[model samples]
Target: DAGITQSPRYKITETGRQVTLMCHQTWSHSYMFWYRQDLGHGLRLIYYSAAADITDKGEVPDGYVVSRSKTENFPLTLESATRSQTSVYFCASSDWGSRNEQFFGPGTRLTVL
Candidate 1:
């Protein structure tokens, strides 16, 4: 039988630790976003930056922090990892317009034990 299948990805970590996830874009986009996906919340925005040195917290930004020092890079850090923070994190980038489409990354799944 000839079939194609995809492998599962996993990330494991301990509590009270710090983890940093990074995102980068090829284009010089002015806007970057970080989102976390959970069971009930679906996809919730964690943080977003309009430009360099300009960042704002999103809906679920309590345990997450984001920084944008350049147009092509945006890194998200978890201050203190917790079991409740186990979720998939996604990073996206877009140009400086409301009509522009946002491109998302493959996503990073982090599990805190």
Candidate 2:
């Protein structure tokens, strides 16, 4: 497998602007998730998908994503990015046998200006 990956290792955007972080994996995991890392909040779940068109919103972030149709790509879009959204975002995937064990991407560092 090609393993998990996150694009745009770093990004800078102004408030009210839009930003999209891309994630991909070759392992074809059934479960995928997006999370943001911050000091007080730690790793906060933004969104997740159990399969291709099946998705659910997490505790934070207004993001749009889909799997299966794209094969392995999961893109998260911030319709209007804000300074409060600045953080390191990560993507993870887990297989059927090990739902609790996940493989994470390198992470994308986004800075909202």
Candidate 3:
């Protein structure tokens, strides 16, 4: 079974283009999260969903959006890509009440020119 997976492991786009990153997990976890990893910021949370339709904004959400209509899938979209938004994004999931341990997918590296 695929524990967690991310699509388009790497992406390069123009400054004004839009980019969507996909994430999927076989485990039916109640919580899912999207995080971006950068040099100084480490891993900053971009968005999170407690359940299928309950989503919330995280530390960095200005240029990104996320939705989870199904328990196993959570996708993040950058409305208008920018060079500052270029970073390695990671998707993670955890069961309810188990916030300490999360399963993370192979990250997606996005570079905006």
- Give lDDT: candidate 1, residue 103: 77
Q: Find the 10 residues in a row with the least total lDDT in model 3.
A: 94-103
Best by lDDT: 3
C-alpha lDDT values of all predictions = 0.81, 0.85, 0.94
Could you give candidate 3's per-residue lDDT for residues 1-113 as a string of tens digits? 67999998999999999899999999999999999999988999999999999999999999998989999999999999999999999999999878558999999999999
Candidate 2 on 31-100: residue-level lDDT in tens? 8899999998999998988888778889885644434456477888888888888899999998878847
**What count of clashes does model 2 give?**
0
Model 2 misplacement above 4 A: 63-68
Candidate 3 or 2, higher lDDT: 3
Instruction: Please give the TM-score that candidate 3 achieves against the real structure.
Output: 0.97
Each model's TM-score?
A: 0.87, 0.91, 0.97
Q: Which stretches of candidate 3 lie above 4 Å from their native place? A: none
Name the regions of candidate 1 deviating beyond 4 angstroms: 1-10, 98-100
- Per-residue lDDT tens digits for candidate 1, residues 1-113, read 11111112356889999988878777777888888888888889999998999999999899888788787788888888999989888888878875868877778888999
As for model 1, its CA RMSD to the true structure in angstroms is 6.1
Candidate 1 TM-score over all chains jointly = 0.87
Q: How far is candidate 3 from the true structure (C-alpha RMSD, Å)?
A: 0.9
Q: What lDDT does candidate 1 reach at residue 63?
A: 87
